[model samples]
Target: MLSPRAGAPPPSCPRAHSTYALAQLHAALAKSGLSTGSATPATAAAAARACARLGHLRAGRAVHGASAKLALLPASALLPNALLHMYASCPGDHYHLQLARLLFDTMPARDAASYNILLTALAVGGHVDEALELFEDMEDAGMAPNEVTVVAVLAACADVGDMDLGRKVHSYAKRQGYCGNVLVCNAAIDMYVKCGCVDAARAVFDGMGDRTTVVTRSSMICGHAMHGEGDKALELFAAMRRQGVRPNGVTFVGLLHACSHMGLVDEGRAFFESMEKDHGIAPAIEHYGCMVDLLSRAGRLHEALEFINGMPMEPNSIVWGALLGGARLHRNVEVGEEAIQRLAVLDPGNDGYYVVLSNIYADAGRWEDVARVRRGMKLRGVKKTRGWSTVSVDGTVHEFTAGDCAHPQATAICDTLDGLLDEARRRGYVPDTSVVLLDMDDAEKERVLARHSEKLAVAFGLMTTPPGTTLRVMKNLRVCRDCHAVMKLISEIAGREIVVRDRNRFHCFKNGVCSCRDYW
Candidate 1:
């Protein structure tokens, strides 16, 4: 019998013809073996997009392997761009930058989207310099930077306080009409704010032709609050609300932080409640932190502890730290002990908790307990972190460690510290030596308490900064009670504002009054 023609189908319904065609196509692909091995560029691109959508790394890698086998993956600009996005969106994957960089270097045709992706990855990854470098490279390559590029570059500038670079980027953005983009404008505003250039930040905020987003408003509020401008922050918040922009979680965080900084306990509480009531925003852990800070500042230690215990979610180290701090502020040894215990269990390897516990015990005159805790610490091999401070003066950043005598101005710093102590004593600054937990004589304890990092930073601030200018110091640890008292005296006697940013919160001293109200 004569064989049927190649295109002819078996004696079946006409609808079966389509299925026959599909089978032939599959057979052809299987004969080529390309489908089973490496994926073609078209297939890789599609797979990359699908992997990104599903967030399936294993499948993505398999597709990538297939592409590599065919040499059809990431060889083209569009395909690599898609792959770059896939890598960038993977959480905790820092190698995205390397991939992005490689793809960016090898791409024969670069687009604004690719450049923006790489720049954003760099900025968010804390590689500000690399972001700037990429921006410069993009400009050199004659690729007109788009709105996304402007925002990414501005964010990088903001992170490092590169005002010169920021100004350049701002000018470029304004020229490119990117200044109208809310995201670009917000990044500009945030950059200025974080760079300690509040005036610049305000200028950008005011010049915004469009309405600000909640994130932009929150950034402005937080910038003002952090720089000791609570009233300004509140004003911005009010303006944001009046403009019909709903405040988000970050907005509430900024508002509550502003109130906490200014010791506005009632206002802070109202904002905290309104987060859920008026704004319909659930309070996050940071919000709870703000509340704990507020109550602690107000000397409502019992209330703060209760609030922490009543949290809807499991408390983290931050909450426990705040609770421990509040206990120390109120001298509630029992609460402090409880917080310390919980903290130890929560973070077994953290040495700060142990040190704070010892300090609390020492503050409460529980010498035996302090000794026992110290013994336990030694047995567990828990070593306390050494305190350090960084002071920037005259374009030089000076670092000091606890009991450090390595600075070129060490002698002057020590003498100035002695003078400050004498002046403080004259002004009724009694040293609370109880913070030193070592089993030593009273004189030795006094000496140990005298050399705390906060004291060192304050002394350096007094000796260096102008007579009436505010002293801004940052410490890596909490300020001891004795040092806190001395700072209050120094602020009054020297007739200057003293701002200390410790590990916990900002402590402002003016005229013998700390912004914490002796609560923290």
Candidate 2:
């Protein structure tokens, strides 16, 4: 396999003889200056691969410049593919992301691996739309996709909430005879679940044949928890036990989350205990966070506090935030104050904690305390992140923020909201003005609540989509009490399923009943 034409060393250079051995090649590059400007494309490819393996981003970028300047980039697809991978694998932040795409777009030629590498980089960097476009380009070029390509594309589909595109990718995978491939199946399961098709996800899981692994099982568990099917998730866990498939930390994370979402207080405690006793897996911070949320949501705020105080390790903001959220829900000012004190020490600049504490005081009619909290907020110069929502329909994603009245279809959406308001009154939709926290009039509070991002997105979904089409909305924040109530009534009136994925979990509304069961 050693050919000097392809950068394989002659009898003299032993370390650089094997292109597959990146460690030895890295040593060869440093010891022999193999990345000379006059080096062939093949030599540079090997050097770039070595740099990638050694995490030498500076050297790799220099190799990239030489490859372009020496006109070695167009010598063969192999070198460019290697260069593409080098840029993608380099250690950097957003700069690496930008460089990866720039290299991808400028490649003289590309194969399936070229697309796969860039797609993976984009997917990991949260560029779902660009990854999907690259996937389409690969298809348009008539390049056959392999298992890795399909997996990355499926992950991108999941992140973008493109159920329609996911189905097509699943079909293509099957056609390519990748139905039995574990990697493809796992990605398919994850994609389907994230796209709000849990049934389809389960079907792929069941049909993966003998290729199942802990990853696949964990994905199934996560899907069930995400869609509010906690019972099914628990049942799947039981099945995993019977099958003797050892559950790992991720499996337990999904289990605890399912229990929390379902309000299964006793079950959550039991699982948390068993993780150490039966499974021998010590609880991680995430697990502790889940337990805190479970206990708090179960109305055991004092127990949650005790649990945090008794933790073997220091409690993080997630744990305190869970307790604070529970206190907010139950209007427990004492616990809220304790949480605020701890949060001020742990995360002093988080405006959210102050807002939650202020709202708690407002709920109790302690306007002066609320005023104090606001003053502290201003003095500390902490600002809350604006809430935003997105609804994807017909391959286009529409975004709405709090007080957003500038969308293209604002008139129709507002009209729909007005109609919902009329129906909301008849259906007993009272604005929970306590959430306002500010000393404002009832009308202003009502307007603010109505213009909330989730409501606007849902209204836009109803206005733009066909009747009976399920509306899928996503929020950057948790659904408030008033909006959650209005969504249920809107589902009943519209006679359409409304699936809202919030910061915490999913809420599916049909016939005035939500999948969260009014807990989350």
lDDT of 1: 0.73
- Report the alpha-carbon TM-score of model 2 versus the true structure: 0.90
In the range 162-274, model 2's lDDT, one tens digit per residue, is: 88788899999999898877889999999988877788899998887667999999989988998899999999999999999999999988999999988998999999999
Best by TM-score: 2
lDDT of 1 by residue, 21-140 (tens): 445433433333345664466655666665555444444444555566777744666677777776665524565456657756777777877887777777777788788888888888
Q: Which candidate has the highest lDDT of all?
A: 2
Off by over 4 Å in 1: 1-86, 101-116, 126-146, 153-177, 192-200, 240-244, 309-316, 378-383, 391-400, 403-475, 479-501, 506-520
C-alpha TM-score for every candidate:
0.68, 0.90
Question: Which residue pairs collide in model 2, if any?
Answer: none
Q: Each prediction's Cα lDDT score? A: 0.73, 0.83
Which residue pairs show backbone clashes in model 1?
39-66
Range of the 10 consecutive residues with the lowest summed lDDT in candidate 1: 8-17
